[model samples]
Target: MIETYVDERDYKLLERDRYTFFVLKRIMGGECKLLLSDHERLILCFTGHPFPVWIWTADDAAEEEMEKAYQLAKENKLLTGEYHFNIKYSLAEYFIRRAAEEGLELKIITNMFAYDCLEPVRPDTESDGGIHCCEMKDLEELVDFMDRFHKELSIDQKDISGYREDAEEFIRSGNMYLWKDEQGHNVASCKYAPDGDMASINLVFTRPEFRRRHYAENLVYQVTMKAKEAGYVPMLYTDADYVASNACYEKIGYVLRGKLCTIG
Candidate 1:
């Protein structure tokens, strides 16, 4: 995939904040192609290894532009397209619906808490799961849980492993939380990327069997707790399309600063 991934330095330069926010990661497998249609920039990032396909736009483009890119990918056998934007800061759903009509799957990520954004969250009537600080010893469980998570999310196993390796290294660089169940099986987790005065939360994932179980809530609870205790503002970036994740972040208390249109 990497071999075919079209190198787009200008796109990265424009959407760097998305990478800074964890809303977008560079395509590491297969190849990427960038399409320029009149005024809008369309990026087609596809890995033939059954990985999730991603479509990004700098902003709202002419409908024909997106359609053209969509048609090209459809011709090339790519089916997934993700649109990221924040509810509080993004353009409404008209474009997202259009993407759907074209058969592109959309996923959005947002801040965990958005409504009354405050530190020290209020607990919800959550599941019976606990969050633990994970060490390298838990690598096997982490990989297993991630495998199931990808399956549930319809992501390719190969893509998850490529990411899991980097995730382990990133988690090791900070305080990592591993949410586990009564039997001590890890269910959810988050990694805090510490920078100067802020620690951006990245890679918040829960196992498929644990979805809607509030494992993500509780795990985020611990993640925010530790971040607050360390005296840094905890923050996260969402692609802004996955409304469910955005809702989860809002329920958790993450405030939306703005929307980012990742051109990856």
Candidate 2:
């Protein structure tokens, strides 16, 4: 049987899977609800507001128990609408197969990678541009970048005001940075947000005209360095199909740590 509340044993299980459950560590005891199988071998952490579902299954967890836990979660309406399964790469096949058995299509979205200054990162490309924290004066340009970013990714585009608001928020957070050429033109941008002991570096983009100048690599390197200097482990998610981006991150010292699959 699956239980809704987690006990001491479950906490220990969570600790054993800390890397796979990093996001859970940052949100537990708040908006998240824990669901555990009797042996605490299979678990789910579902957050209400954000509506993300995370699943974990121990190597020894019985197949029957895993199915039971998933069914119970569905009965509780936890799997309604769209639910992406954020789980370890080792468990991806099991979930994907199970989703197929249930007539639900699931797919691997991206691989998660982490980095520490310990790895010998490739030397930053020599570029004439310098990194600078974004300010309100850069809002208009930031909005344009945001638009191109979503379009390039094929993600649903947000309205102009939504992009403007995102730009303003990034600027106010003081974590967004732009790579400005010697002539003071913004060539690339990158930003990070701290979550518990991890800082997720995202929104790394360079304008089309500046693609080959190594501006993006330089900007990401600078932003990642800032994240590390602030005492947070640096990490990011990248689409597995995006070979160039993955190659870029690897050159900067990031190592593939895990993967997430989306279930619908």
Candidate 3:
């Protein structure tokens, strides 16, 4: 059976499932809404505006239950428009095939790897004095870094004005940090997206001139350490095909946990 749940308390039932913890944490943080099948076996979380509907199903979830979950989303208009869907690889093929049969097109598919780290992180000894939280005065430089970061990845570029606004909010929330060299030139940056006891390290980037210097790695290590120190389990998602980044996360002590696919 499928049902919709609105109460924040419903998230407590998901605490034991680490694979779904980030989505559950987002729901608990009021960042999204939740729908469940059989109380938790099949979970669908919707974060409106640019974010996708994250679907997580138990390994033993029957095919019928998965189909029902998709049907519920369609009936509620959740699958319409330009919204995207993110699900495990084990279910992505089935979900995509089924959606096509229903005349819903999911054109772009990207494979990703999820990583999690539980042990305390050790910061690079040489990076200690160069890393620090971003301040309001650094907004313009941060925006420049973000633009270059997006361009390098071929991701759509955000309007500079809008980007500045978001960066300001991120700085005010104490979620952004940057790495600077001895001359005070910013070389790399990263940020945290926290939900409950789980926080995802995101926006990791380094200037092309600083690519091989381990600046990006150091920034991620610092952010991960901060998240762990604050009592949150640190995790991150990266493109599976991005070898350098995948290797960097592994070197930073994150272990591969699962694979996810995004369709839009």
**Quick one: best lDDT, which candidate?**
3
> What are the clashing pairs of model 3?
none
Q: Across residues 1-264, which tens digit of lDDT does each residue of candidate 3 receive?
A: 556653433464455455434655465446555555456566677756555777767666688877876776777687675666777666677767887898877654677787898874453544523787999999999899888887776554577896898899889989899998877889898999777678989889988887777788888888899898888889988888889889878877998887777777
- Per-model RMSD to reference: 7.2, 3.8, 3.2
The per-prediction tally of clashing pairs is 23, 0, 0
Evaluate all candidate structures by whole-model CA lDDT and list the values in order.
0.56, 0.72, 0.75
Candidate 2: where are CA atoms >4 Å away? 1-15, 29-39, 42-52, 76-81, 111-124, 154-166
Q: Name the regions of candidate 3 deviating beyond 4 angstroms.
A: 1-4, 31-38, 78-81, 102-108, 120-129, 150-158
lDDT of 1 by residue, 1-264 (tens): 112333456345334334332322334222444322222254445444543344554555565655565565556644444323322213224335655776754444333231223565556756685778877888767666666655654534555667579558755875877888888878887877655456677567887676788888778867887887888777776545678877777777787765543221
Q: How far off is residue 260 in model 3, in Å?
A: 1.9
Question: What is the TM-score of candidate 1?
Answer: 0.54
Please name the candidate that would achieve the greatest TM-score relative to the true structure. Answer: 3
Model 2: colliding residue pairs: none
Model 3 misses residue 3 by how many Å?
Answer: 4.9
Q: Which has the better TM-score: candidate 1, or candidate 3?
A: 3
Off by over 4 Å in 1: 1-118, 147-161
